[model samples]
Target: MYQSSTIINHIANFTSQRNTELLAFSLLKSVNSMISCLSTKIITVNKKGEVRDHLFFENNHCTVKDNSIEIDNVLRRSFEHMHDSSLAALTLKTKAGYSVIRLLHHDRKSEQFLIINLNEKMTKENDYILSGILSIYSNFIQLLNESQTDELTGLANRKTFDSAISSVFNTRPREHKEVDSERRSPNEIIVKENHKYWLVIIDIDDFKSVNDRFGHLYGDEILIHLAQIIRSNFRNEDLQFRFGGEEFVILLSADNQMECMQILERFRRNVEEYQFPNLDTVTVSIGVVELKKETFHITSIDYADQALYKSKKSGKNQITFFENMLSQGIAKKSDIQGGSVDFF
Candidate 1:
């Protein structure tokens, strides 16, 4: 049996977190504390119920091994079974042992599930408790997501970017190195070692003219369409933000400068080719900078902005890198003093 005080404490702890990733970790810790499970993991899935990625995982014993293929197979089977029935939770036997899978939440973008591996079947009381906890967790997540999301674009709001960039600095290394494919799983898309964080600022070229000619409503529609394009082009793990009115920011990881350039150039080309309502064509100017662990967040933004300035000056609908600008003697580093650089 679970204690009321212990449950209440876990609820309070998770609810107190302002960051979504921190909240996920707290939720896993709470589940581990209350349940007698061998391991617990929170996995993200698409609308079709295919497992896309793992958010958090905790193994309680040394004997348990983390197998991505086995987990995906089990989840696929469990999802199919759940769809065929009216069950809230499903218990299935795996090679390691029995596992319990429950749909924690389903949002507009994706669905999240909690999978717990167990040595034996859970008791009725434990199952009931787990369901109740999940209910609370789902509610909290919905509320938090709304607060952090951009109302118009549905991307993360500017305030959320402030918190996310700090995490990038904390986790990524200062120096860049070559990616070692031998050490990484063939299935893994994001390689942590030698990977670098990139910050790109994208601005719709002459967006003010579009608003002036077509009206604010049409301009808003363009933003929405652009956001959708952004979602389709980038990975689900990438952090996208709307810095308000024609400007957007993307934070992603790439193995090297060449890879990063390719990703950004592809996005640029997509934007150039997109057909917009009441418009002949739409184009965007992009500014990119590789983030170093020791660099201040403000300085990084300034560097990207300087590169953006170069793009706008040379002509719009282009991509520019900060390092390239410095090497070519086109841009200078900022003093980090207050005030904005006038573009017009």
Candidate 2:
């Protein structure tokens, strides 16, 4: 029912999205519009086969949820035989009509799935049309990723972080950026009273010495290793960004102060114990602050940076909380300084 001009406009709109997640959402919405007879859903899964986010639409109802275990299990069983680059299509005789369901593997590492439920009967012409639409979606996704990802570490770059935080977390004042719920796991949901969104800045201790003693290549490897350890320590839903060089940032949600402390402490310990080849005693200093809806993103980063400064000043390989520093009168709001650490 849609014209060629309408489809081209949708493709243009999808390519303009700033991040991969947004692109994924836009792709589904555009497809749904161009093919009005189809129902669409976009689901993102992690390497562990867990659903991180899902968007489902049908009739006049729409549901967006953080994660669903039952849905994950069902999808896994349904598409267990398909591999990468393969499209699985099926026909179902539902009460509504003779519908078609298509499962598409969007990405391997992320396990993103593009599921479409079409209300029309299957036909050769419809299959060709669907294939063309998916091709456009795939091309746009690749372009978006290239612009947003860090080349070496495979994490998000600073540019991605700047846009992501503002777009994802800073929507409603005092409310955590609710887009996709930003949950760490599908099971972890934000409860108003019991949860806090924490912003953390991680810096490798004395990173200059590593680059100095060993060549830059080895230093680069150390940075890669550090990134791997960080990925292992944090949840997939958490937004992890490599600001530059040895510095990284994580926006995470925790149940409370103790849990927050535990998460950071565990990461600190993990980095302390990891033995990097050709490197001696690689460690990191962390600064953490609970992000509030009213606080500006830059200010939150400064607070976390100040906390990190305290850790580096006393000794590396430790975690410091901004609230604790404030309570102890160690640092004041006006005293926090950004750009003190040399991430380069």
Candidate 3:
């Protein structure tokens, strides 16, 4: 068994350059070869509903192909009747239309399937081989999921951000060219091109008032409600995160700064107007930073945060731009508290 660090180091080497599907196939093949007569395959249908081979494991002189309408039908059926985490049967046929193993997955995203032949003609060796291989495969898939999920908001955590950032940030193809210097670096791995991006950090207005007035449970309820509102209003391109108590972060793309700020302001307005249950009305303060590809994480996060502090200090429930707020004396730190400024 490879140490977790060793596996991570291997993965790190492959970062930005590796074909993740092939790497996943290699991991499956390792488990497959450990069990005789075991083979594995992963298939995914495209946006157009066309079935395609995503990953396949080779057995002693035998191969697995991913293309098949019959397999697609069974896979889709398995998805319908039982959850991806469920243990269930999916009757399927091979490329030549021969009846093959029934498959069950532990996850839908990775689309790993444990194959079994229900035909009585199967040997005990085949059953043992399949069982052992599946046990290992399922463990691997579970690990992948644990890495991607966020504990707080049930959203795609920062662990899932790398690929997402790349698809939207890395614009030019010359960067994709193979050169020792041009390789996918720790930062370069997620570059994409052709759109302005914004990273908006949000904090619920007067969140401590809830904990102080009601209770921690009520505070949590407000957080959950705030999460729901952000999720519903944001576009699919945006990724939402609970950075910690009362704070959420959103990454989104827009054509320009005007559009980005407008979207965030609208989100702010929605929060301001919406009636949260058990509360009169809730408000949020947002600090939006326009992101350039290389300048992803700027000290501007602090600037944005200072802007947010201004919103809270002057008044709650407002959107504050870092540059404008910082230029004036509005963002200065103070030992003073409870005193307030005019509302926007």
What TM-score do all the candidates reach, one by one? 0.80, 0.81, 0.62
What is the lDDT for 325 in model 3? 62
Regions of candidate 2 where Cα sits further than 4 Å from its true position: 36-38, 44-50, 60-62, 71-77, 84-103, 106-110, 167-193, 335-344
**For candidate 3, lDDT tens digit of each residue in 1-344?**
33456545434433323333433444444434443333455555443445444444453222334435445565566544544355444445455332334343533233344442232334456555445444544555456546666665666566555555454455544321322322333223322356666767899988898899999988988887788788889964477767678888777777777888788888999898888878888899887766543443534456567777777877878777765664675554333222333458
The whole-model lDDT of each prediction reads 0.76, 0.71, 0.57
Whose lDDT is greatest here?
Answer: 1
User: Which residue ranges in model 3 land beyond 4 Å of their true spot?
Assistant: 1-87, 95-130, 140-150, 156-192, 294-298, 323-344
How many clashing residue pairs appear in each of the predictions shown?
Answer: 0, 0, 9
In candidate 3 the C-alpha lDDT for residue 332 amounts to 45
Ranking by TM-score: 2, 1, 3
lDDT of 2 at 47: 64
Better candidate number, 1 or 3, judged by lDDT? 1
Model 1 / residue 27 / CA error / Å: 2.4
Query: Ranking by lDDT, best first?
Result: 1, 2, 3
Q: Write the per-residue lDDT of candidate 2 for residues 93-191, one digit (tens) a residue.
A: 655656454654555566566666656665666567677877776777677677777899988888877655654433233231324422222112233
Residue pairs in collision within model 1 = none
Weakest ten-residue segment in model 3 by summed lDDT: 174-183
